[model samples]
Every structure is written in structure tokens, then in C-alpha cells.
Target: MKGLVYKGNNTVKLQEEPMPKVEAPTDAVIRMTKTTICGSDLHIQRGHVPTVPVGRILGHEGVGVIEEVGPSVKSFKKGDKVLITAISSCAACGYCRRGMNSHCHTGGWMLGNTLGGTQAEYVKVAHADSSLYALPAGVDEGALVMLSDIFPTGLECGVICSKVQPGSTVVIVGAGPVGLAALITSQLYSPSQIIVIDMDENRLSVARDLGAHHTINNASGVAEAAAAVLKLTDGIGCDSVIEAVGVPASFELCQKIIAPGGMLANVGVHGASASLHLEDLWHHNIGITMGLVDTVTVPMLLKLVAAKRLDPSKLITHRFKFADMEKAYATFGDAAKHKALKVLIEYD
Candidate 1:
């Protein structure tokens, strides 16, 4: 088997590796069929995620077939097609019971971080029953791959956490994949306005096509962007502000454009500390929420896809064979240059 291995100091290499087997009572070995690179993978490569040691396989989103399942795995068996979740949960842990599977004591984001991931011919999945979803017949595998991470992250962290409601005004800071996911899902609540801000005009254009009522290019700077947002909102600011870019400036922009009593949801995976302007926000009665994706909504999302209410496949902008894993990473890494959103990597 061949897998993409992360080498420290901003490097990754595709190398031949031994096949994975079921190693625990609750484990299952998946023969990957389709997978995609995530922004988090780029973060890991850039040395932002220190816990990810060298030699770790670099992926957490994909669809695969169950090659083998341990004795304790009952919900799935050999030959079942499944969607691999980015976060793993025991479903018996305290955090899991609270629906915070991303913090599950025994399993939370182990794949592509602390454990081998799905960017290979075969990858081991822990807590198999809780971490994998059986694929519905005839669904697009490329779209299912989006379900494994970005879509859920956007729905849970950006839309749900921010409390987007009907007739409310919303602004998403970042037009990246996760931001676009948030843009697409936020419409489910029929927010009166959906404004997306990004430095890239190409991404902003895509946001418009995906239903953003307004788009702003933040290239001029935060003040100008905020002014533009304020103008769009009639100087009232947005009812809900979602920060989807994992950067200090983007987070700051979210703070600047939130309504007095608005909710600010931080969906970005920040690798560095971002300042919270408590002094300025003291009189504003605003709410702030951020956390890793628990993927508790995968089932509901699947239903939406089945019903044709949501089309995640629109996020896919490129595809590559398993052997072209390196090229996939390159394209995804230079996303702006390639106008790429999501790059799907498939196995034979």
C-alpha cells in the first residue's frame, strides 16, 4: 500500500507502506475508495499542529469499504461502504454522551493526527461503530467525502453555534471551503441576508453562486470591509457573525461586524492565539463559541443530500488518483492559484 506521510518542516511524501489491519476489539480496517485533503492538513504541514508527529498519514476525510472489522464492531461488517468521520468517538465516554465527540476521552480526531489516516489504500478506524457511517446506495461518493468533515464542521460550528435564525442577518468571514459550507447551510434558516467576506474575488464569486446575498473583498483592509458590511446591514451589523478563516485578522473582522447582541461563531482551527476585545465588547451582550466538529449531524445531513436540499458536490473542484496524492496536495496547497475549493483523491 502507498500512503502520504507528513515530514516535519513543511513537507509530505507519498511512500509505499504496509497495509493496516484491525488492531482493537472496536477497530475496523477500511480499504479507502475516495478521500480529500483538508485545510487542516495544510495546517499540519505548515507546523501549526504540533501534536501531529512526523510519519503520520495525512488525511481524515473520505469514503471507504470495510475490509475487516474486529469482533466488537457490530454496526458494520466486511464489504459495507462507509464514510470515515474526521473525529472518532467511543460513544461511551462522558464527552460523547454530551454530544461533544470531538473531545471524546479515548478517541477525538485521532486519524491523520495521532493515528494513521484515510489517505491510503487501507486505514485503520478506531471506535468503528461510532466513527463510520454506512453509505446510502447511489449517493455521490465525492459528496459523501465532504460530509466526513467540512459540511458538518460548517453546520455544527458555524451555523448551529452562531444560532442563525430566520429573518436574521449573517456574515461569514472567509470564502474558503468551510466558509462556503457555512454559507450553504446558513440558508437553511432563511437568514434575511448572507454576506461572505474574503480576500479572493474568485472565492467571493463562488459564494455568490452558492447563495451569498453579498460578497466583500477584504483586500483593502478590515476597516473598509467592516464599513462595507455595515453599509449592507444599514449600519446595524449582522445578527450572526461566523469566522471561518483560521487567522487573527479574520477573527478580528468578525468582532468588528457583529451586532450588539449578536453571536460570533469561530469555526476556524486556530493554531495561534487571537485576542478577544473584552473591553470593547463589555457593553455588547454578544456570545462567542468555538470548538472541534463532533459530526453528530452527519445523519441529518445525509438526509438533506438524499432529498436534494443540499448539494455538497459543488465544493469539489479537482480530482486525482490515489497515485497522484502528491499532486493533489500541491493543488490544494496552492488553492488560490488553482481556484480550487476541494480536491478529491480516489483509489483504484
Candidate 2:
């Protein structure tokens, strides 16, 4: 089997490794059909995620076919196509019961650290009954992979966390894949205004096509960007502001631009410390929530996809074979090519 191994900062390579097998009665093995390089993967490679170990496989978004199952695995079987959740979770935990699977107390994260991930020929899926979602037949693997992370993360942050209501004004502070996902998910709520802020013109254009009512280049200035956002809101700030970029500046901008009593949802992975002005937030009575998206949201997202409500095909801008994993990461990580929205690494 072939797998991607992160050796050090800015270093990743494909290497031959032993195939994974079901280690426990509740575990199952999957042969990956499609996987992707996430922005968070870049962070792990660049030493942004200090918790991730070197030489570990680094992918959390993937879809594949079940090749083998353990004795206790009842929900899945051989030949079943499935979408891998970003993290495996034991559904019996307190956190899992509340739908916060990402922070599950009983442990569920595989890949990149605990075990080899889906960025390979095969992966061992623990807690199979709770961790894998059966992919509907005829679904595009490239598009369906987004359900593992980017799409659901965006949907949770942009729609659910922000509590976006029809006719509400929403602002998203980034035009990256997550931001674009947020833009697409925001449409489900029928927000009156969807403003996207980013430094990249290409991404902003993509945001425009995805359904953002307006796009602002934050390079111009946060106040200037906020002014454009305000213009769309008829001189008031947006009712919901999503900090999709995760930096202090972007978070600050969201805090500054949100209307009083509004919701602020921070979706970006904060690699470093980001400060918040308590005084500024104290006067407004705003609600602030920031963290990783719950993997438990997969079932709801799957239902939407099954109902033909969410289509992420347009977000997959590039694809590469399993042999080209390193190159695919480089293309997706490069700041020069703003054209790569979501890079899908196909296994063939």
C-alpha cells in the first residue's frame, strides 16, 4: 500500500507501507477511492499543528469502499461505498451525545496521528458503525469527499452556528474553500446579504459565483471592507459574521463589523493566538463561538446531499492520482495559484 508521510515542516512524501486491517471487533478496513489535501493538512506540514506527529499520514477528508469489516461491525459490509468522517468517534460519549464528536471524550480521531489516514490505498476505520456514512450510489467521489470536512464545517459555521434566518444579513471573512463552502451553505437560509472578504481576487470571484451577494478584498483595509459590508446591510452591520480566516485581524474585523446582539462564528483553525477585545465585545452583547466543526453533523449534511440540496462539485478545482499526492499538496498549498479551490487526490 502507498501512503503520504509528513516528515517535517513543509515536507510530505508518498511511501509504500503495509496495508491496514481491522484491529478490533468494531473496526473495519476501507480502500480509499478519493481523498483530499485540506488547508489544515498544510498547517500540519508547516508545523502549524504542533500536536500532529511527524511521519504520520495526513488526511481527514476522504470517501472509499469498504473492503473488510470486523466481527462486531453490523452497519457496513464489503463493497459498500462510504464517506469517511474527519474523525472516528464512539457515539456513547458525553460529547458525542451532544453532537460534538470532534471533542469526544472516548477518543475517535484516526489518521495523521493515532493511525494511518485515508490518504493512502487503505485505512482502518475504528468505530465503523458511528464513523462512516454510506455514500449513495452514482455520487461523484470528488464532490462527496467535501462532506467529510470542508462542506460540513462551513455549513455548521455559516448556517447553524450563526443562526442565519431568511432576510438576515451575513458576513464571511475569507474566500478560501471553507469560506466558499460557507457562501454556498448560507444560501440555504436565504440570507438577504452574503458578504465575503478575502485578499485573493480569484477566490473572491469564485465566491461571487457560489452565491455571495458581495465580495470585499480585505487588503484594502478592514474598515473599508466593513464599509462595503455595511453598504449591503443598509448602513448597519451584518446580523451574523463568520470569521472564516482565523487570524487576529480577521476575527477583529468580524467583531468590529457585527451588529449589536448579533452572532459571531469563527470557523478557521487558529494556529496561533488571536486576541479579542473584551471591552468592545462587552458593549455590544454579541455571542462569540469558535472551534472545530462537529463531525456528528455528517448525517444531516448527507441528508441534504441525498435530497439534492447541496452540490459541492464546483468546489473541486483540481484532481490528482495517488502517486501524485505530494505534488497535489504543493499545488493546493501554493499561494501563487489561487485557482485551486479544492484539490481532490483520486486513488486509482
Candidate 2 regions exceeding 4 Å error are: 335-338
lDDT (0-100) at residue 269 of candidate 2? 74
Candidate 2: worst 10 consecutive residues by lDDT? Answer: 106-115
lDDT of 2 by residue, 38-88 (tens): 888888888877778887888888998999999999999999999998878
Model 1, residue 235: displacement in angstroms?
Answer: 0.9
TM-score, candidate number 2: 0.96
Q: What does the lDDT come to for candidate 1?
A: 0.94
Model 1 spans > 4 angstroms off: none
lDDT of 1 at 270: 79
Residue pairs clashing, model 1: none
Report lDDT (CA) for all predictions: 0.94, 0.84
